[model samples]
Target: MAEFTSQGGILRGQDVVSILFPVAVIPLLFLLRSVFFYVKARSQFPGPPIRNFWVGNLDQTMANDVHEKWLQWNREYGPIFQTWNSPFSRVIYIGDPHIITEITTLNWPKSSAQYAGFRPLSGDALFVQTNHEKWRIQSKRLAPAFQPHVIQAQRPCLAKHLSNFVRAMDVVAEQNTVVDLSSLHILLTLDFVGDIAFGTNLHAISQGRDCRILQLFEIILPELMKCGLFPLRGRFPILQKTRLMYRAIAELRSMAEKAIKDARQKGDEALGTSPRKKISDILATQREPDESYTFSSKELCDNYIAFLVAGGDPTAHTMSFLIYQVLCHPLVLKKVRAEIDANIPFDTTVPSISQVNLPYLNMVIKETLRYSSPGFGTFRVCPVDTTIAGVTLPANTTLALWNPAVHRDPKLWDNADEFDPERWQSGQPKVRGSYFPFSSGPRSCIGQGLAMLEMTMTLATVFRRYDLSLESGFQMEYLPSFTLKPKNGLLVRAILRKF
Candidate 1:
């Protein structure tokens, strides 16, 4: 009886070990596999990372101002570094001009996962096209519409919007009330882009209120910045189908379709009406000269929405930064205002592009773009196994070209942190990849001319008519999102000039 009892106890012990073995081995196998992949992906490229086993460096990047985090990392790791997005995914950040020039000038395809968020809104638009050949053809067809002469035609529309913006500021100046200039810049840009893109005066500037589309964009942009950049919310498809996102997408689609329809119906009547050929007309009529390529109605809508979103956000943010930076430096403001006063006449409506010859004003704008570096960063992916900066990068690996790091590198620029507009006086100091606010090469921003025009025109108009001062106790912080925006808003007191 004693021997039989001992045998049963041994069997029971064996049973317990059997039950626990698989559970222990499963996680161990997963961990080993993860490590193997991580090691394989991160071969040779070095980074400064305090990494978590599961989330990698993602936790460190999830913050209010993540781009600043990138700047910090750049300082620690030098210009080129590898960062882990997940245990299995490696991202390389490159700031070297040679690498950047090679990637952009070669027209590298964008990583699908990295740019996936833009697709739901832009829908394979020119900026977000995954097909290299398609984008090339589309860019060619759309080139005429954005030529210097064509963009010049929009000056009247921009001038009209600036006039409205100035009048609105006059009210706040008279009241001696502090106004959120960031929000106002958004409103003004929305109105300007509205006229130029859809040929509609949205009156966002005149009313000083957020229109439905603008409100929808405000909601959509943050959601995208959250899920698209980090992808935590994107894990669940249900969250992507939220009502607010649905509404914004639907409304944007509707607006684009209507604009396209209107342009098609009106034809030359529509074409002749705008100060220049509007983006809507351009989209509606644009095709390959040989008719080999033409945008479908869906493509038209996508491109139009792209224009509205792209045309407004970065320009607005840059303008806001320009104003804020000038306000912060009283001497800079005095010089810029003096330049504007000397060049731009007090009652000049639709100031000719040539007429606004303020070299100092142009310097201020360029310097502001560099200081703010508002487009965030350009992302590209290696289409095939390739080498960049002497480091081997596997196919499909994401490469981040962060402008702020490049723009603020002390090695690249003397006193890089200091806001010096004089640095840009000699035709923006050719710095190769170092000074690319609009990015560079084939995939650079198409609406850059329009943005520059709007910013310079608005700056000249405002500085000529008003004296801007930062609100007391107001601290400016960078609100890094899809585009770098001013946190809260740039509150300022605008005192109308009697000149």
Candidate 2:
């Protein structure tokens, strides 16, 4: 008989060995895990002990606002910290300008897995694209679309849209309704992007909840973000093949392809039906030029779909949140409106893009961008073993720099918490990497110019004719991911100015 039951079979010596072996091995495995985590962590720069394998801060990460949490960590820890992703993965959050600049130096094909997150949906649009020669070739080919004269032509259309927007606002004001301006702004921006992409308005501006376009947007964006945040599932490609994620992706792809096919057919009809009068000339320009770049009809479809997703939502969220910040400071709102009226009259039928350079309006936009950046920070995995800012990091370490934290660094900007635009103008040390509302360097937003113009112009038109105010019951919350947007919506009240 044995002190412990050995139903299978156990020799006299084997019973003792079997029981002792597990007891010895279990602690050893734990010791090894702890030792590895500790050695790798300490070998780098020092940081808070909060990052532990057992606690798994991803919960804390998902729970608290990363923007606030990052700010808190910077206050507690220094500018640089070494953290862990899981049992054996690494994550770094860099706040120093020099470190960030080195990482964003445009390694081209050597760029990070960020491209992978968007590639499934976007394929290879300029945003979320890292196809070395493909992007360069396509970018050069597409650059003609944004030339001075070509971009100038769109001004007429944008101005016309802005007038329609003003009229819409007038109606909303008359109703004395509490408007979630964020949702409204998102719809308006969606309309603008869809119009430019397909040469007609999608009429998303007044559409209610669960519209096809909005539904498709929610499907793609949240999943794409989920894929990025928790990519363990993606490290194994077979997991993506499972029905769990595949169906979600299929829905987004179906909608994207349908939109693309629709746009292509419309372009074809325009070219075939009226060669001399191309409806949206942007479509006509998609054809290959001397093989500098040639896009398949499918590629054209994907590109427009990509632009719609990338360009529309971020700008809408930014514009909406900008107004929210403006609401917080009625004095700032009044100042911005005064600048708009002085420069471009409230009833102005149309104004040149150059006219949006009104001082306070520009200040407000700059402040808005700083106060609430649209897109959150992105990640990079080292191509090979590398040390950054005294952190000896190995390849495959995911490095992320939280811009929201960097933007609010008191060491970098004055009254970091306060909504002050003067800091940008008043000899503000030109803080490096301090304010990358749009991610900086070569990979910075290619559509920054267009988005900047759209937001500034639209806001100019609205503030000039409207006395902006938030309703008593207004509230806002942010859901951070690829871009930052209000969770429920941005509710506000507005009235027409005496002007």
Candidate 3:
């Protein structure tokens, strides 16, 4: 009787404890997680706190011009500072030369979460490739074709397309109507990129019609930028407009795949004795004995999309901004005009690399790139726990290097914000990381040589043939998207210059 009573009592006690244990531990676990995050935040790098526990700084910075916010914060908090992006994540913004040089040279993989926004369009392409090894392989394979000589090999093709561009502008000039230079430039760049990249003329300029792909590209950025910051964008039906953009991008992918197939079938026989290589041709012809070294058709499509994303906006916006800035400053325009008149022959279809000796022209372009950097910033993630800029960054921590902030830093140049092209001609030794319009180190823009050549040639071609002036009392305002664009667009009056 005594043993049975003892066993029964023990069983009842065990049941009571089991029921209470979880009740006590559930809240305890919640408390422990909160404590862990708090401790981590305090122990790791310093950063500004978010507005709330649930959303962090998303509420404050998500809707606004985020880059402008970064610039403001950069001004407020020295060269290196951190901001809580979410309860689970913190972002460290680095613009200091030493820190930027270190992170970029190390070629830190971009933070996967931050760059996930870029994936829907350019899947695993060079810009959105989260895997470092894969990125390295792709970058190396693509590097040789972007070299100056290789880019120059495409000059004749570029000149042919540019002549079409000039004819389009000439038609508008003949009408004597105010031209939206911004849209015109965007179309021109799209056609140029399409021709050079895919070996197809989109005919956006010559036909004076908007390419569906280009239109898709434009709307995608503004919506995607929002989607990138707000995860719940899909929950709202109105913002669901981005779905159409995705569908359009899918259609574009199909177009690219077809173009590649057609190009492969045709071969380089069209070029005959002298073959000029386009990016599409290079991609089609690339052969590797090892299966591992070869790129798949999908990979090629993704790469061409990356080219469009990177090349399309930056080129057009930079050119548009350059024209706006030049028109805003008369003396700057006169100096550039003088340089063009002296060096470039009036009827020269394409100034050969050696024939183009416009120092001031080069300087002006460099200064514009400095003054209005199209790529305002870049994202990098620390791969390993490392110290940078006198602070320790845990692995997977996201860092942003704000280029415009660095560009406009008063300490870096004399009157940095002033429109002064002569600063480059000052003969001062260049600061290494201070002005990287194309970025620097291993992963810098491979298309930079092509971009510079195109800009120089286009500027010489257009300004030599036409005199452009901004509409009277015109004002320029910027819209922050994937690239800084003129909010109102660039309106200009064009007159044929009698040489």
Candidate 4:
């Protein structure tokens, strides 16, 4: 009996060892791998000291002032430096315009690690798609909808929405109320994009409130930032607010599905009859004789969401920043208003795309894109070992084209920190990689033409009618999210201009 009991005890001890051994060994291996990479990265490039071995500099990278931090690091460690997102993930930031030009010109693959967060919202859409062939096909098919002519045709539609927006503000001005300008920009852009992309009047501007879809986006974007920087959060439910994200995603997809159904029904009635095609019409229509390129119902929904994700927020944020900058600098505001008054009629006449030609206005737009870039940066990866600017990076290494740093680099600009529209007054060719707010290369933003038109017309219409002043005692702060936005929203008093 005693011998039998001893044998059972020995077996239980062996079972415990079998389970614990791999657990101990796996972490040890991970630690060694992290150490090896750390040593290798340190030898090759200069970077800030590692604050934590486990999370690395991820906390700082995710902070609200991350752009400023990158600028500081650029000054201290040179234009090119390395940082670890986590113990296992390595990132290299390139702020040197020459190096950035070289990398973008080559058209290297986008970094999956950086864009994985978008997959939850965008799926295999062009913005988040990593496959070159798939991206090419998608880009080709969608290019027509954003052609200059096509976007120009939508000018009337844009102007209609802007008229509603201005009227909404006119009421605010009459009340002598301080309003959150950022929220108003969000509503205006949402309504315009909703009309163009989904063929539905969200009435976000006319109704003077955000729709359910917009509210869902607000929830989804922050979660995307979390998943984007820390990829594991995307894969594992426990690591993120999966329930909230999934619910929002489900609702958005459901809305997209309904839009697709409506578009299909409308197309059946107007088959080969309509000349002008909305974005939804283009997305929903099947590719004749080339069924392979035709989007599945799911793909249609995903791409629909992609258009919403890309179109609305970034442009709105850019406008908000432009307003903030103009308001802060009274001289810039005077110059912009004077230019507007001199060229555009003071009546409620929204100018056509070709007619809205204010040189100083264009300069202000350029300077705003540079000084307060809405996009944080773009990411890329090399398929093989590559050397850029004297540093050799291994295969699949994530590289960031740090736009904020590049735009503010002293080597690239004069008085880089100042908001000077005059910097562009010379009309000289820009330093190639120094001012890519829409990014560069084949993967650049396709909707940039539309965004520019919207901005020009909106600015002209708004400043022509109203003189805006920043709320007293209001200081600007940025929100910590995928894009740079005002933390507390842009508060201003809109005073109706007297002719």
Candidate 5:
């Protein structure tokens, strides 16, 4: 016993270190393994510094000025840029249109679905799901609902709503107040989509804030963003067990289910005296495209919720920022206002979103999308071994690409960085392969037509009624997210036109 104690307990310093060193080395070993894979993969592409090790360069990109910064990267490194996931992971940034168009159109090796765990059940249902066959079928079936013929019918409704929007704006204008043009734009969009989706008229334009349901929607959606970014949580039992996260998800789910139930009753009330029926409300009642559990009413709920987001916020951001641009370029604003006055004539009334199909207004809307794109940092997982730009890519690689980076390529635009509406003035609508605001191909945004219509009408109506100028010295910039948003509010003074 004495010998055992002396030998075991009083072991030599070298022996003690030998035993302790391995334990110390274990964590380092694990870290090294992760780093090795990350570094090796990242070497194949071009990228910026990792910057902050905790979050990599993503923080810089995530800042309010991310759009400009990312575009700066494109200027710094031509088209393809390399990105790292902070201390680990590899990302490829592709901004060239030739490459973008080719990648989006190809029947290719498999593409990543990105819809892991609850993502498939979330607002990401249509875009995130990887199943090509199902996507083909579902998209085809759903296409009819958004066709020009059907969408045109809704234009009258949209026009009427825009009239309310103008009245609300005029009230703000009449007081000579520095209006929160940005917030108001969002309110208008929320009420518009709500009218169409759940038949809820929060009257956001008039009330100037969301209703209880909209507030709940905002709460639920911010939580939904958490799942969208990290879609694996539902399967990883521990993450699923996290009460706060799960509870928030539960709340969102409950809210969505309630919205669906409420949707059934909304159509009657929404037909004008109410906010009026949107195409989505009609779709919600009719047959679903697919009978699969994946596309059921529950799925419809998720898709509609997603649709509201995709439809509303981005367009709001676009219109608001475009207004900011109008402030910066008075000449452009004057041109637009003049066009509106000439075509749409101000009276005791205003034209609908469809009435102002002016050439220059179209250019402004298109340019706004190009300059400050709605979505940024879009990610897709590689489904199979594929080749991009002649470089072989292994299966299961996550790729994050930005449109602003590519759209700003000088090669794509003569003065890519400049805000020139003249590029689209001819009414020819010619776009280089690399200039995609609505992401290209079969997987492109489904609600693009609606968004375009919304922008055109909003621009036409507002410019027709009011001439906008910044509130004495406010310079605004872009806020980066999955989409580009405006930082600080768009505060502009509007002068009403009297016929």
Candidate 6:
């Protein structure tokens, strides 16, 4: 009996050891991993102290002015510094123009972990595509649609939409009422993109209402920002906000699918008679010329939605900021107006792209893009252990080109904080990678040409016929989102210019 009791006690002891051993060993293994990551990140470069082993610098990133925070950090810690998204995620921010050039010119793949937020909306579209070969083929397929000639051919569509915008503003000017230029710019761009890209008459400008597509984007963009900040939110749609976001994404995808179907049925009629094919035509193609890869129906629909969103929001926000900046500085405003007056006629006839010769206005646009670019940074990832700007980065390390920091770096630009358009006019050559508002490299913004044309035309059209002033007691406040958006909206009063 004594022997049996001893044996039973030993068995119980073994059971306890079996249970407690894993609990203790598992935590020990996790600790080792955390330590390994922390050491690796610290050894790579100088950075802000990691306050928490788990959340590491994520608290600072949650602040409303995170971009400004990044700038401050860039100043404190040299040009390249490390920050953590989580214990498992280390982000290296590059502010040095030379380093930026190296990374971008090499054409490193974008980080899939960083770009996961965009996948929910853009799918495998070029904006978030990480696979090199797939992205290469897809970009090649879509390239013709945004060629210079193709964009120039769409000038008439742009002019028509701008005309509608001006007519709407004329009514507001006659009544002497405050107009939300932010909202108007968004509507105008949407109309232009809808007509030119998809042959869909959103009528946002003429009808003076938000289309269902725009409304859906209004829901999706903010959620994208949230998902970017908290990646877990994207993996699990348990929260009400996340659930709503998924629903909106579904609806937008459905709308895009329907539009694709309609375009397919209508054939070439859908893309009007422009010799240059529109984005819709390119996306609706059944197969590539070589027939090696055929775009799935879902890819067609997602790319369609991607173009719609990309073509509208950033351009609209940029135009709004451009107008605001010009108006705020009277000297700048005077020069821009003088240049516009000299180049464009005072009458309502919209000037053609070739007819306008406003170098000063172009400078102002460049300055605005430098000063208040809609996107704060561009992200990339190294596929193999690589050396950039003298630092050896481990394979799969996330890299962010901090555009705002680079653009406003005192070392890069003289009087970096000041809103001076003439800086661009200096005969001295610009530093490579110094002012990439649309980013740099092969993956840079595909629609930059169209965006520039839109800005030039809109600025010339508006300033030629009207003088604008900020609303009484107006103060500019930026909203934190996927892009830098004006809080509430920009309120301004317009007075028709007399010839």
lDDT score, candidate 4, position 80: 86
**Worst 10 contiguous positions by lDDT, candidate 3:** 1-10
**Cα lDDT, all candidates:** 0.77, 0.67, 0.75, 0.82, 0.67, 0.80
- Off-target runs (Cα >4 Å) in candidate 4 are 1-34, 207-210, 239-242, 290-293, 427-429
Which portions of model 2 miss their true places by more than 4 Å? Answer: 1-38, 42-55, 106-115, 131-134, 233-249, 262-285, 289-293, 387-393, 473-475
Candidate 4: which pairs clash? none
Residue 223, model 5: lDDT of: 37
Score every model by TM-score.
Answer: 0.88, 0.82, 0.90, 0.91, 0.81, 0.91
Error of 6 at 460 (Å): 0.7
The TM-score that candidate 2 achieves is: 0.82
Q: What is the C-alpha lDDT profile of model 5 across 1-499, one tens digit per residue? A: 1222363366666776788999999999998998887777667666777767766665554355656767788888767776554554445677766556666777332234234533633544566556777667767766766887666667766766777888778787899888888887878788777766655565777666535544554444433443334443344536433344456556656766776777655543554454323676656555535732324666677767667677887888889878887778878888887787778755625565446678888888888888777765355555677776676665676555568777677876778878888787565445455666776676778888888887887777777667677888788866554356666879888887666
User: Where's the lowest-lDDT run of ten residues in candidate 2?
Assistant: 275-284
In terms of TM-score, which candidate is stronger, 1 or 6?
6
Output the lDDT of residue 383, model 5.
64
**Least lDDT summed over 10 consecutive residues: which range in candidate 5?**
107-116
Worst 10 residues of 6 by lDDT: 1-10
Judged by whole-model lDDT over C-alpha atoms, candidate 1 comes out at: 0.77
Q: Give the clashing pairs for model 3.
A: none
Candidate 2 lDDT, tens digit per residue, 403-498? 877777788777888987776675557666776776777667656777877788888877776777777766677777557778878777778777
Q: How many clashing pairs per prediction, in order?
A: 0, 0, 0, 0, 5, 0
Predicted candidate 6 versus true structure: per-residue lDDT over 1-499, tens digit per residue:
1222355454455666777999999999999998887686678788888788778888877667776877788888878888877777878888878878987888888888878877888899888888989989888877777888888878888888888888899999999999999989989888888776666778887665546766877888877876766667788888887888899999878777877777666654644554435556555654557853356778777777777777788888888888889888999998987877777776755788875667898898888888878876677887788876677877887788878778888888888889999998769688998888888899898988988888888878888888799999987777767777887789999999886
